[model samples]
Target chain A: MMLEFIQHLVNGLSLGSIYALIALGYTMVFGVLQLINFAHGDVYMLGAYIGMYTAHFFQLGQNSSVLALIFTITVSMITCAVVGFLIEKFAYRPLRKSPRINVLITAIGVSLFLEFSGQLLFGPDPKFFPQIFKPSGDWSIGELKINPLQILVFFISIILMSVLQTIIFKTRLGRAMRAVSFNHDLASLMGIPTHRIISYTFMLGSGLAGAAGVLVGLTYPKIDPLMGTMPGLKAFVAAVLGGIGNITGAVIGAMTLGLAEEFLVGYWAPTYRDALAFGILILILLFKPTGLFGVKQTEKV
Target chain B: MKLLFSSNSRHGIASLRNWILALVLIWMAHFFVADEIDPYFFSIIMYAGINIILAVSLNVVNGFSGQFSMGHAGFMSVGGYISAFATTQLETIYPEWFAHSFLMSLFFIFILVLAGLGAGFVGILVGLPSLRLKGDYLAIVTLGFGEIIRVFILNIDTIGGARGLPNIPALSSFGLLYSWVVITIFCIWRLVNSAQGRDFLAVREDEIAAEAMGVNTTQAKVRAFVVGAFFAGVAGALFAHYLRYLNPQTFDFNRSFEIIIMVVLGGMGSLTGSVLAAVFLTAIREALRSLQELTRIDFRMIIYSLMLILLMLTRPNGLLGTRELIDFIPNGSRKKKKSLESHP
Candidate 1:
């Protein structure tokens, strides 16, 4: 029983980290633009597809080389960054002066556009994510077994998160991002070049989402057009749980959500596993609307 | 006091006559279409009617009350499943002779009302907590509520689970659907034009100010949700019977977005705009069917998403911008009066 619980824990942590990566995209974008950027998930979907294509093109399946995986992930992230940049330039940038609801609706529009276009381009059928490395079994320490892939997932997530933290806290560009998110008009007045900062924020956030996509693809080994929707939604829930605009809060939220889901499916009714995220969301919204780490802001009359 | 009562009765009689006249015209139109027009066209009209109800009711929450609810379809499915279940069970219990009886139609109406009430109760449950939230947060909560409802319904086996509850009897006709549509429009129009509706508008315009002005903003929002959910329920009942099938997938977020599209494309607070937008969008959907067939690709949604984006960009207030069809007519006194009232 203990071994089984450990197994679930390992699995849950790996999944939780992937959600944390995706949730970072939501949190950062929400922080910077105050828009949910609903298309972020679709961008992640595109990244996975791009990674698959890159692997297929280079014929990377025979060798389980770390360099090859890195190359594919890099290519996917760059492409997704460009895609995110373009989406912001065209779709969201024009609506900056509009009502928040209008922008929200447009975001939904962009999301649908990406999803349907993805279906058109990739076809609706699920595709196999090419194995970039040699297929292997779990590494067992006595009774408890751990997949090397889980360790890889956890390590990559941590490295990426640390890199993100450094960028947000220790870098000039990150300062500009924080400034813009604080107040766009004020930031621009301070000569922050707010539009450029916002665009860069999109690229950074979307790049993280792309990396997450590749990671999820490697772990799950299946990619489809609609595959991103559920994970995206759950990650959004995690973002909300962690306080939407708070980075560290998002990561903690993702981990909590992932572990809860794993335990729920493992012990409780598996059928209700999907509903659990929204259930947490409703409960959280009812009790503490600001989220776990979010500071309350009173509206001024 | 005597004079006021006499004027009120006279006004009531005049409205009652108008309602009867509208019903008679609708019945005539229903007969003409049923007997003469193609079944495809009839189905289109029925769907348009349903969309009308969905759009107008959604406008109550989204437009007038200024609350965002992306879960209208969730209430729809609730009503659909409940009404479908009731009909299926009742059909088995009653004789075949009872199916064609006048009493059966009345029973079906009762079931639809019961379904509406059921959905309204759920709306209260969803709205009460979420109403305290503002703007995007409230939107997300409502959206979450919708998804939770869908997922829960998917887990129930007796209602056919993922396969969906099917084989609902077809008790709805063009007349029945449109009559309900008319009733829905009339009720909503009256409610919006009444003194109570001003509170809804006040909440929509600014919740803080509305509260400061002694408006029970929460009650207004909850009322909007209940009214919206109630009519959406009625529409769902009509829709279930019309199609004789009820799939959980039928009332997903996509369906919710489609209804939102109609309300947004129409002037949000305009009753006539909602009706016209429903008809226009439905027509466009049908017109696109030929293109869909030609390409053999489902580009209809692509076009729709593009339209929504473009519409938001260029004309966010939609076609009418909160003005009714009647308001478009050249009425110097009414126009001057409206302008004065708005500015003042």
Candidate 2:
């Protein structure tokens, strides 16, 4: 029983890390624009497709190591950054001054557009991830076993998240982003170039989502147009759980959600895993509404 | 608070006239359309009727009330299950009456009404807490609620699990569906044009301001959700009987979005607009059926989604905006939809 618990904990951490990566995109965009950016998940879906292609063309899937995975993640992130940039430029930017609901509806439209078009372009069938890094089998400690792919997913996600933190807090552009998130009009009044900062936020957030897509593929190995739907929703729940706009809150919320889901799948019914996250979302919104780490602001009546 | 058939209001007369005309048209459809119409065409018309009900009901919450609800399909699915379960259980007890009889049809309508009430109850549960949250949060919570319903239904074994509940009795006829549609539109139209409806519109325009005006914004918002849920439930019951199957997947977020698209495209808060868009979109979708078959790809959904974004960019007020179709029916009476602050 103890070994099984340890195994689920490890599994949870790895899964939570990917969710955190995606949740960052959701939280960042909501922080800056107050738009949920529903297409962010589909952006992650595109990332996996990009990674798959890069692997196929470069012949890196077979007999490749960490370098192959690194290159693939880099290419996917760059491509996804471009995709995210265009989406924000066209889909969202046009409705900046519109009612928040219009932007939201447009976001949903973009999400559906990406999902269906992905099916059109990528074909409806699920593709097997190229397996750039071999799984290296299982390593056992006592009765508990750890999968190397899960370890890789965990290590990569942590490193990326830490880098994100440093950039957001440590750099000049990062400070600009924070300022923009604080107040869009005020930041613009202060000559912060709000549009450019918003663009940068999308790029950074979407880049992380892309990285997550690749990592998820590395672990799960199956990729499809519809793959983003469930994970995207769960990641949004994670973001909400963490206190929507709070960066660190996203990670913590995602970890909690991951552990709960993994434990449910491990001991309880697997079918309830998706519902549990949403159930948590409703409860959190009902009681707290601000999320675990989110700072509350009094609404202007 | 009394609306529709109440003889006091000036607008009531016009709406009552419209309802009578709708009733006549439905009667005409039962006799003319049902018998002479091609089966394919008849089916499309039936679907259009269902879409009309769904769109108008959704418009109650999204259009008139100003609360963004993305989980209407969840309410609809709940209602569908309720009616389906009750009827199926009733079938075992009264196999002969459930087969082909006036008694069975009456019982079916009763079950559908019950479904609407059941769904409305669930909507209250979804809406009460949701009202405390603001715009985007409300939308997300509703979205989650819809997914939770779907996931919950998927886990249940009695309702056929992931495979879906099948073998629902087909009781939908031209008269039945449009009668419900007309009633739904009439009820919603009356509700919106009523004294209470002004509060709903006010809540939509500005919740804080509405609250200050003693509107009881929470009650108004919940009212919208409940009413919307109730009609969505009715629509679901009709839809289940029409299709004679129940896949929880059918009522996923996509279905809710499609209904939203209809409400938006028809011009939010416009009852006639909802009807027009429902018919127009259903027709367009039916036409697109050939394209889907030819390409074997779902470009129809792609186009529908793209149109939503483009429409929002160009005309966020939707095609008809806030004006009624009756405003255009008479010569020189057609007036432009007032450009509200929400649009700009």
Candidate 3:
């Protein structure tokens, strides 16, 4: 029983890290722009597809696996960032002055566009990603056995999270993004091109989403256009659960949600797992409208 | 007090003429469009009318009332399944008692309306808890409620669960569907023109100000949500009877988003716009299906998405916004007066 519990914990952490990555993308964008980038999930989907193509192109199934994996990840991230940038430049930037609802609609439109476009381009079949890494070490400590891949996923995710946090708090671009998110008008007044900052934020978020997509692909070994839908929604829930604008809160929320989902599926029927996440979201909203860490903003009449 | 129709009596008269013309055109289209109309086409048209009802009703809450509800499909599914069960089961159990055609149809419509009321009751139940919350929060709650309903339906095996309820009798005909569509449209038009609708508008425009003016914002919101759910329920009943099959997947978030797209594209807050947009969108979707078969290109949905994005960027208020056809009609005397004033 203890061994099984430990296994579940490792599995949960692996999944939790992916959710945290996606949730950070969501929370960061919401923090800066106050606009929900509904297409973020589609970007993740595209990333996975791009990775699949790269893996196939290089014949990585029989070739040098590590180099192929690195190439796939790099290409996927770049492609996703480019798409995210274009979407912001054309669809969102034009409507920045419009009502928030209009922007919301545009976001939904972009999401739908990406989903269907991906479907059209990739055909509605789930493609298998080449297994680039085989678990090298199976360590048994007491009753628990740990796989190398799980540890790798955890370490990579932690490194990415730390890198993101450092960029947001330490770098000049990150400072500009923070300033823009706080008050776009003030940021613009201070001569910080707000539009450029917004674009960069979207690119960064999409890049993170791309990395998460690649990790998810490696773990699940399946890529489909619709695969991102559920993960994206769960990540959004995680963002909200953590207080939408707080990056650390998003990570915490994602971990909590991931663990909750795993335990629920393990203890109960798997069918109820997605519903469980939504239920948690409803409960959280009922009690704490600002989320676990979100600052409450009062509307002025 | 003047009657609700008095303020815009002249515009009403002109609108009555236009509505009559539109009705005539619809009848003509129904009659002359085909040499031998298949039952399939009739059913599709009937479903289209039902979709119009749902889309328009949703417009009342999401568009006019300025609420973002992604749960209209939940109310629709509730109404559809309940009404289907009622009409079919009650008919089968007591065939001898309800043998009369008129009585049976009346019973069916009655049960359907009651089902809609039940859906409205559920809507109120959902609405009351989160009516005080802000827009995004309310959106999340309603979305959660929608998913919960779907999950509950999926779990209830007695109602057929995930496989869905099937073998329902075809109760709606072309005439019946068209008539209901007319009645629903008229009812919505009247409601929007009434003082109640003004309160709804006030709430939409500025909630705090509306409350300050004694609008009872909570009550107004509940009323809009309940009424919207009621009509959605009716639409669902029509859908169940028309399709003769019902599934939980039919009421998912995508379905709700489709209806929302219809409302947004039609111009939120415009009754005529909602109806027109629904018809246009349904037609476009049908056209796309045919195009897909011909070209072997499955990018129709992509086109739709692009269109939606383009529409938002160019005309965020939608094609019609709050303006009705009557507002644009050439009022010769008013035009002359305006010209005279400008010249002076």
Candidate 4:
């Protein structure tokens, strides 16, 4: 039982890392734009498709895992970044001055568009992602067995997250991002090119989502047009649970959510997984609306 | 307030004339177009009408009340399932005892309305917690409530669970559906124009100022939510009877989002806009289905996403914003500016 519990914990962490990556994208955009990018999930889905196609093109079935994984990641990230840029330039930029509700609807429209277009283009069948990485070894500590892929996901996620944190906190672009997030008007007044900053934010967020998609594809080895919907929703919930605009909060929230989901599925039933997530969201809202580590916003009349 | 629309009370006559003209046009369409419509198309129109009701009612809370509720479908599901269980089971258990069709249908409609009321009561319960929250926080709460409702429904065996309930008698038709539509429109229009409507507007505009001016912000929100939920319930009844199906998935977050999209695209507080947008969206969806066969491109949703993005970028206030068609008339000028200002 203890060994099974440890194995679940490892599995949960691996899943949580992907969720954290996706959640980070949501939190970053929300932090700066104050807009929920409803298309974020689709972007993630796009990432998986990109990675899968790229691997397939190279004929990297499951053998040349390292090279194929790297190639897929690079290709997916670039493609997703481009898509993200276009979405921002065309769909979101026009509605900047419009009511927030308008943007929200537009986001939904974009989401549907992605789903349907993907179905049309990709044929709606679940594409098998060519697993490049074969678990070379497994380590067992007591009853808990640590798979190589699980370790790979954890290490890659940590490295990427650490790098991302540094860029957001320690760099000039990060300061500009922070400046704009606090007050776009003020940031512009202070000579920050608000549009450029927002574009960068979108790029960064989409890139992260793309990377997450690659990881998720590797883990699940299945990609479908509609695959992004659940993960996207779960990531959104994670972002909110961690506080909408806080990056660290997103990571923590995703991990917690992942662990909770795993435990619930293990103890209760698989069907209740989503319900459990929503239940936790309600509980969090009831007690801490700002989310864990989120700053409470005061409305200016 | 009366003086705002009255030019020494003479202009009131002209405004009333315009209102009557608009009503006549709608009535004419109802009588002439509805009568000649094919049964299949008529059923679709009836469904559209129900959707219009749901979208418009949700707009009251979301658009006019300035609250983002992604849980309208939850209220709808509650109303639908409850009414279905009541009308179907009661009739099934004792068919001969209550054998009168007209009377039975009327009784069922009453029970459906009461079921809506119960859903409204649940809306109040949900809305209460949301009173303290704002924007995205409130959105999540409502979303959570919607999901919880779906999950609970899935677990409840009495309502047929995931398999869904069937064999519901159709209670809506061209005549009955239109009657309800007209009544709903009238009541909603009246409500939006009344003192309560102004309070709702005030709350939407600036809750702090409204509260400062003696408007009970909480009460106003609750009222809007309850009223919205009531209509959503009624729409659910229409759905239940028309489709003769009820499932937990039918009321999930996606359904909630669909209704929200209609409300948003329709111009928020504009009642006429919601109705028109609902029709437009339904028509577009149907058109897309046909187009898919010819184009071999399943990217219809992609086009929708592109359209949404473009719409937001180009016209964030939606297709109509808050302006009704009447507001564009030459002599229908009195309250036009005010309506626009209050809409988005």
Candidate 5:
């Protein structure tokens, strides 16, 4: 039982970190645009499929595994960043001045378009994600066992998150992003190119989501066109849980959600697992709409 | 009070007569119109009624109250299952109870109301919490509520789990479904014209300003949710009884988006638009069913998504926007007056 408990914890954190990565992307775009961007999930799905193809072509698992992993991640990230940028430019940019509901509908349209297009292109079958890194054996401490891949997943996620934090806080572009998110009109008045910042934000967010897509494949090793639907929704829940618009809060929320889900599956019926994330979402929205890390912004009359 | 009530008495009597005359006409169509149509065309008309009810109800919260809720499918499934279980179980145990056509129809109406209330009860649970939020947050929360409902329903073994409760008696005939559709559209239309309904629009237009003007935005929003969910439940009952099966999967987020698409395709705040779009979209989809299988390009949905994107890009105001159909009629200046009052 103790071993089982530890197993759940390690697995949960690994899963949570991936959610955090995806959630961070969600929160960043939301922070700047105030748009829900439902198609973000499909973007992540596209990332995984792209990663899968790159790994397959390069024979990532058969030769120079680490280099192969790096190449796969880079290719997927760049491709997804471009896709995200184009989505904003063509689909969302025109509707930026429109009502929130209108943009949301367009996002829904984009989401369906991507899913169906992916289905038509990818054939709706789940492919075994190429394991670029050979298992280096598990280490056992007393009754508990931990895999090296789990540790790598944890470290990689932390590195990416820290890098994102630096970009959002320490860089000039980050400053512009913060400025844009705060007030678009004022930011533009202050000579910040608001539209450019919005595009960059989408690219950055999509790139993070791509990294998450790869990491999730590394963990689960199964990729499908529809795989991102649940994770994307869960990551959105995580972002909200941590208080949307708060970067650190998103990580915390994702971890909390990941652990909660694992524990739910470990102790209760597995069927309740999916419902648990959404249940937490409702409770948080009602009780703490600002989220664990969010500062409530008052409505300006 | 006497002056206010008496000034419209003559017109009120004439309108009441017209309503009765229309009802009698519809009742006659039940015998003649319903029986004459082929099943394929009949299904299309029935589905149009269902979609209209769903769309119009959704408009109260989304179009009027300005909340971007996406949980109608969840509420719908709840009502569908409840009415399915209650009516089917009652039939299984006491087969003779709903034997007479007149008595059975009344019983089915009761069941639909019960289901609507069941759905509305869930709506309160969802609305009370989600109503506190605004904009996209509300949308996600509502969506989360929908997933929660679907997951919950999916786990319950007694209700057939993931398989779905099957073999429900097809008690929702054309007349029955049509009447409920008329009833739903009428009730919501009346609500849209009420003083409180105006408050719903105020909240939608500008929540902060509406609050400043002393409108209870929360009350108005929640009223939209309850009224909308109530009709969604009724629609659910009609849908389940008509299909004679209840699958939890039938009420997924896709279904919710489909209804939203219809509402937006019609015109957010226009009743006539919702009805027309429901009919139009359904007809188009039905006509394309064969081509969908033949071409295998998934062109129908691709075209749909493209329409949604281009519609927002070019005509985000939707087909009719905020204008009711009556406003287009030459003599219906009362609608013009109402529009001016609401907007002003």
Candidate 6:
């Protein structure tokens, strides 16, 4: 029983890391724009497709190398960054002065556009992601079987997160981003080039989503147009759980959600797995509207 | 508060005459639709009626009340499933004895009402807590409520799980279906034009101010939800009978979004606009069906979604911008009434 618990814990951490990656995109965009970029998940779906195509183009699926995997993920990140940039510029930027609901509706529209367009472009059938780097086998510790792929997913996620942290906290552009998120008009008054900053923020967040998509593809090896909807929704729940605009809170929420979901699937009925995140969301919203780490603001009359 | 059958005799008599005329016309049209109209065309008309009910009901909450609800489909599914279950059980008990009888039709209307009530109860549970939330948060919570409902439906084996509940009795006729649409529109129109409806409009325009003006904002919001959800349920019940099958997938977020598009495109808060938008979208969708078949790719949804984005970008106020179609006509009574009130 203990071994099984340990196994589930390890598995949950790996899954949590991917969710954390996606949830960060949600939190950051919410922080800056106060608009949930509903199409962010579709960007992740595009990222996986990009990675798959890159791997195929490079002929990296047969005898995989770490360098080949790195190249594929980097290409995906860049492509998704461009996609994210376009989505923000076209879909969201035009509605900056509109009512919140209008922007929200447009976001849903953009998300649908991506999903259906993806179905048209990539075909409706699910594609098996090219295994660019397959670990030899699993290593057992007592009754617990540890896969190297999980370790790889964990390490890569940590590296990406640390890089994100440095970018957000330790750089001039990062400070500009923080200022813009603090108050858009005020930041513009401060000559922060607010539009550019918002655009960059979207690109940065979407890049992370892209990386998450590739990591998920590496782990699960199946990709489809509609695959992003559920995970994207769960990631949004994670962001809300962690306090929508709080960065670290998003990561913490993602981990909690991932662990809970894994445990639910491991022990309880698997059918309830999808409902669990929403249940937590309802409870959290009811009990603590600001989230675990979110700072609250009084509404203006 | 006593809004039933307007107290003003002249106005009441005119509206009553209009209702009678409408009923006669619908009853007369029923025979033509049943016999002469092609089955395909008839089905499309039925679908248009269902969409009209869904759009108008949703407009009550999202448009008139200014609350963004993304779970109208959840209420719809609740109504659909409950009515479907009731009809199937009744069929089994009676074994086709009253399939086309007047007694069955009466019972069917009763079941539909019961379904609407069931959905309204769910609306209370969903709305009472979340309606207090601000716009964006309320939207998410409603969406979550919708997803939770779908997940629950998917899990329940007796309702046929993901495979869906089938074998519902088809009791929807042209008269029956269109009568509900007319009823929904009339009730909503009366409610909106009444003294109480001003409270709903007040709450929508500014809840804080509305409360200061002694409008029980919460009650108003909840009332809107109950009424809106009740009609959604009625529409769902009608839809289930029309389709004779209730698939959980049929009532998903996509369905909700479709209804929302109708409301948005029709100009929120305009009953006639909702009706026009519903019929227009359904017709356009049918027109696009052949293109999809020829191309062997589903571009209809792509075009629909793109149109949504463009519509939001260019004309968020929609076709009528909260004004009814009648208001556009010269010397319309509603317009004249507004002018008289202003002058007085």
lDDT of 1: 0.85
TM per candidate comes to 0.94, 0.96, 0.91, 0.90, 0.94, 0.96
Candidates' C-alpha lDDT: 0.85, 0.88, 0.80, 0.81, 0.85, 0.88
Say which prediction, candidate 2 or candidate 5, comes out ahead on DockQ.
2
DockQ of each: 0.54, 0.72, 0.45, 0.52, 0.59, 0.52
Q: Which sequence of candidate numbers ranks them by DockQ, best first?
A: 2, 5, 1, 6, 4, 3
Expressed between 0 and 1, the share of native interface contacts present in candidate 5 is 0.75
What TM-score does candidate 1 reach? 0.94
Q: What is the total number of backbone clashes in candidate 1?
A: 1
lDDT of 4 by residue, B234-329 (tens): 888878888888888888877887787787777778787889878887777666777777765554456556766666666665677767656667
For model 1, residues B48-154, the per-residue Cα lDDT tens digits are 99999999999999988879899999999998889999998877787584557577777888999999999999999999998888777777778889888998999
Order the numbered candidates by TM-score, best leading. Answer: 2, 6, 1, 5, 3, 4
- Candidate 2 clash pair list: none
Q: Which prediction has the highest DockQ against the true structure?
A: 2
DockQ of candidate 3, scored on C-alphas against the true complex (2 decimals): 0.45
Q: Tens digits of per-residue lDDT for model 3 on B12-116? A: 533455555666666666567633678666555666798799888998898778877878999999998898888778667887855676676667778778978
Q: Of 5 and 6, which scores higher on DockQ?
A: 5
Model 6: DockQ score: 0.52
In model 3 chain B, the worst 10-residue window by lDDT is B335-344
Clashes of 4: 7
- Best model number under TM-score: 2
Per-residue lDDT of A16 in model 1:
94
lDDT: worst 10-residue window of model 5 chain B: B1-10
lDDT winner between candidates 1 and 2: 2
